[model samples]
Target: MKLPNPARRSISPFGQRGLKSFASIPGPTSLPIVGTLHKYMPIIGEYKFDRLHHNGLKKYKKYGPVIREEIVPGVNLVWLFDPNDIEVMFRCEGKYPQRRSHLALEKFRLDRPNVYNTGGLLPTNGPEWFKIRKIFQKGLSGPLAVKRFLKGTDEIILEWLERVEIIRGKQNLDYLPELSRLFLELTGHATLDLLLKSFSRDELNRHSTSSKLIKSALDTNSCILKLDNGPQLWKKFDTPLYRKLKKSQKYMENVAIDLLSLKMSLFSERSNNTQTLLEQYLSCPDLDFKDIIGMVCDFLLAGIDTATYTTGFLIYHLGKSPSIQMSLYEEAKRLLPNKDSPVTEEVLSEAFYSKAVLKELFRLRPISVGIGRVLNEDAVFSDYEVPKDTVVVSQNQVSCRLDKYVPCPNEFKPERWLKSHPLYQKNHPYLLLPFGHGPRSCIAKHLAEQNILVLLLKLIRNYKIEWNGPVLDSKSLLINMPDGPILATFHAR
Candidate 1:
């Protein structure tokens, strides 16, 4: 599995002599107008959009590491399965990495000129994205910024745990919905300085703001997967799926505006001693109100699913492995000896085993099928000279699980991440990128990890988690998520 040294590869400004042409990259035979899109169609199709991670593995085995597919007629996608090639892709990703995801979402935002300045961070590219990113980075980029929310986030987790106890008296529960609410509440606190009260017993009504926001976010994401993966008919005209996306986005937009207005009105009354993420943005001279709204909308939309799915999978793995769960429980107990102890920066730093558990979970089941970048410059990958503007996807989920990159890839061995362990992996750093790499990486990375770690510590200490259902798998809906009901049993200690 040793790859040829990238340094030895022939280098050129654009195209290189004796190197494989981009057209020569092995892939499934694409048809006339349909391209390889038909291959993802119903029964005859060999692939399912929802099961893209599985499809990536299958493609890698069939076509070898580097794969080419014209997903739509003219859109050529190069899939990189080799960690070395993935590293090359990122290295060439340039200052403003153009990730061509959520085209339909971008259109949706641009269509509404009055409401949006740009398509927000997820879809926007170049200087506009960098401008907003720099502003938000000041508020959310590092551990110090995320640490301010430890007490508040812990309070939210405690509330959700109480709700879980009431809802799951003695039965296995589909906990994803609860997890979604918990993350949404956390996102609200971090991004908008609002307590969404998503877990409030009195706000059980389905039409509540929190409930509507959650539903819209989920619905919009579903529509995004369908529209982005399928035909470009939505681009030509207002298709049915496009309309659904608009509706969901419109709802979210209204909610963001209302919340922003409320927060701004209360801004003057707040103490100058502490600043929430929202207040920091409002106080920044460079950002306009519209810019703040765009950021809040993006954060709310993106935050919930990633954290929810990652936590769900982590819990499942812990439940499935009793030894690992016990080990993590022991670590959690040591970190927070009292049941009601708050998760501080010191507690987080000391929870080394808990950190390893998260790292291992990410390797096994990444929240996204792959990390994608629309190549900013022509780059050589796997000896093929791929041109600039081609969408090169880093199939990390498939590669991370491969025996070539990781030892005992199928086993849940957190020790692989521990430096002292015999099974410790010195795998390529690019092999596992759950938060992605470089500047375009997830802005909320620190905050999300803190939230997950705090919740994990609390859950492991409080309950002996168990799962007796069928083995869990993931489905891609913009982000990879648990494919079935998370029917995990929580046995109170």
Candidate 2:
């Protein structure tokens, strides 16, 4: 986790003081004054995270670094070019506190103040955050971190590979939803040992890609989360997309409620059977039904979506990069020779090439282009002053590509991360914000990593992949997903 380059510095805190005017503010004629007042209106249906990042880089180039641009009228915002400034925000989040502004997330049931708060975990803060993090990381320590997920993930991924083979050639195979369901299945079974209930066994077990009930619950979230990037949270309620998304949110909420009820009932019965993470939370003395709903829902929303998208992107890259693909195959074959044998955790871990490949993929296609926090207090960043309540954002997309930190940043080189690589430049230890950083960052970071690593290994080991889509497209929704169906060939290995 250490940075590649060690610099003389001090582990110091930002001294809070009086608010100051913008270092520099860019005029917003890009759209109109509607955006001048409320920025979300223009960005919702048009530009997504990818475009925003690209456009941000362009604007940053023209305007200046740390441009105080507004996403909405009257709402003060800053587009930061310097990774150091962003790193400061993350490292200081636990201390100075960068508050969340997501309305959908704020409305999330699991995040309620009274019961089952996920304070330090998800979208909460203060003591509630502290308690939630302690409880969540309780069982996720040491060996369990690597063993439980790695084993379950490997087995489920093999199942997924077999399913892909079933629909191969005869019909198009969409990897996103399939991988999405697979993560839920793996996480539910391995970590929690429960079924995702997202899809039925008949649907999940079906070799037919057509069998998937890709309903409003999952599909609508694409739009719902998309809307998250738009204007004020309440304004979205008036939009047609918002109405549809709200409905999708309702179905998902109901699903979580049912799962929570089921977990609670099992708890009342003192079910001796080993519990998954959700069940364990249900049994936690501190959490109630509301808290259970909030945290568990957070898990589902956060877990299923990003995993599917990331794997799809990784495979998309593999399809494009044949030499890398072959390298991965060589690594996988060495670790998992018997085609008939199921993938094991050890085998997945042994497939180091795949791990390296995944790291590169994440560096290239992190789900979030940037993460934002509204500074609760005016804080000084070098000479500039970041005002309180101003949305403080960091660009991980650009940070990964920073030439100083990552030499040849555009290349899909995984060796840069290995311990032995000479060209490898250590990124600012806290600057890699793939999962965000500090207290309010992702608590499920380890879980998400294990799932991706396990799934990637199973994929490379069992199937040879070739992309049917263009490798260069920056399509956007809310959280990044494939621009279209990721058509690809999967010859059984």
Candidate 3:
């Protein structure tokens, strides 16, 4: 939607000219050998790329809306703080938008071509990406797919609520770990149809195979992020982290093979009418056990981390503001009046305030520093021409927090998302994209929203939420995760 007196300025495209022909964009001056790398040595020296967003925010404050910086020699990045530039980059992204591939992940999977034989969404584009994505769209997108998941996810949430009840007496709960385990259980049950029992403390205490497997998978994921955000030393030659990553990948693959075997047996015993994602993929002629495992691994990792952290941050925000908490409770009560009422699609649709809270949370505390796309062709953004194959990054956290799109940019105001609010009319809808738009928007968007909403419904219904902790901040590696555990309390409502 367009705003009156739009902040977007007209762009005059340069026809096939060199990027250097244009005026130099404002950014930190680069050193001859290292480019601008020396400036970031403090964070890089510690291998703490998670603090990248903080650094980016600092630069945005210093350099204004549009800045171009060379990350290292031979690698230049144009960081777009304006939402209109983000829109421009997205429109020019072509049919097969090339998301910058995760280096560590690509290497880990390609190293085991036997296991990860085919390229998945992250590494593939064009017809191959479309083909792989279509398979997921049929099973993971649309209302039917979302409907199939809702009941299962809600069941998991209710079970988790019981876990919360059991631990209610604790003075403070470490929200992220517990939330992580809950989403892990939900994703395992929903995708693999295997009850990995991630939320089961007893099973974990017993040191079961599933627990070990889950730990290995998580460790492997952590390694991928660390390596991706750290350095390219592992790319040229093997390192300790690379070795650990390989071992973790092997262990996870072995666990998946075992789980798939059991799943195949269970599929035989059960009726075809009820099938999981793995079973659906198994029906494909070209795909094998390994391919199915690879897909499952993607879903398992992607689903859990995103939902866990998003929900954790939303709750953290709610807990921080008692007024917001009370208003949310009122909305929850108004929507699902009865304590025993089941959370259904119809009920969730009417929970507008709850959805507003989530939207506002994303706008104020976006998880990623920016979303990146490799340009398919030469393009001009804010009248500055950049060449083809250049990596253009939308500084999302910066854009979302700009006063041009948001009123009192730093404040937490869920009302701004409400249609009745005057500020809502002034905003550009693209400014607050938690999920990047276009053909490559998150496939699990609906599933994650449904799950988060259901959990929020139950949470508000059950507990009077409280948060009296140090300021909750976020860190960004491959994705955004809370910098630390949020201290929270749950007084039974």
State which candidate has the highest lDDT: 1
Q: Highest TM-score, which number?
A: 1
Candidate 1, residues 1-493, lDDT tens digits: the string is: 4554767542346455668888899998999989998999899999988888889999999999999998787889999998888888887888998898888999988887788888889998999888888888886778887788999999999998888788876565688888989999999998888998998866667888888888888888887877876788999999998998888888888999999999999998876668777888998998888777778878878898889989989878988999998998899898899877888899999999999999999999887877899888788887798988889999999988888778789899998889999888577878889988999888999889999999999999889988856788988898888988778888887
Q: List pairs with backbone clashes in candidate 3.
A: none
CA shift of 381, model 2, Å = 3.5
Per-residue lDDT for 1-493 in model 3, tens only?
A: 4642323333335664443343477877867876676666764442235676666677788877677777555667778877777777887788888865556666878777888865566656677677677776567675556767777777788888888888767765687767877877877777787777766766655266545555655566566655753456898888898888677667767777788888888788886586667788887776777677777767765776777778878878888888988888998888777764678878877889888888888887775666788888776776577777887888888777667666688888888888887667556656777877787877777777778888888799878988767787777745677877867888887
Clashes of each: 0, 13, 0
lDDT (0 to 1) per candidate: 0.86, 0.62, 0.73
Runs of candidate 3 with Cα error greater than 4 angstroms are: 1-23, 43-48, 206-226
Candidate 3 at residue 360, lDDT? 84
* Model 2 lDDT, residue 342, Cα: 54
lDDT measured at residue 364 in model 2 versus the true structure, 0 to 100: 83
Query: Which residue segments of model 1 deviate by more than 4 Å?
Result: 1-6, 9-11, 271-273
Per-residue CA lDDT of model 2 for 335-354, tens digit only, reads 76776455565665576767
Task: Return model 3's CA RMSD, one decimal.
Answer: 3.0
lDDT of 3 at 50: 60
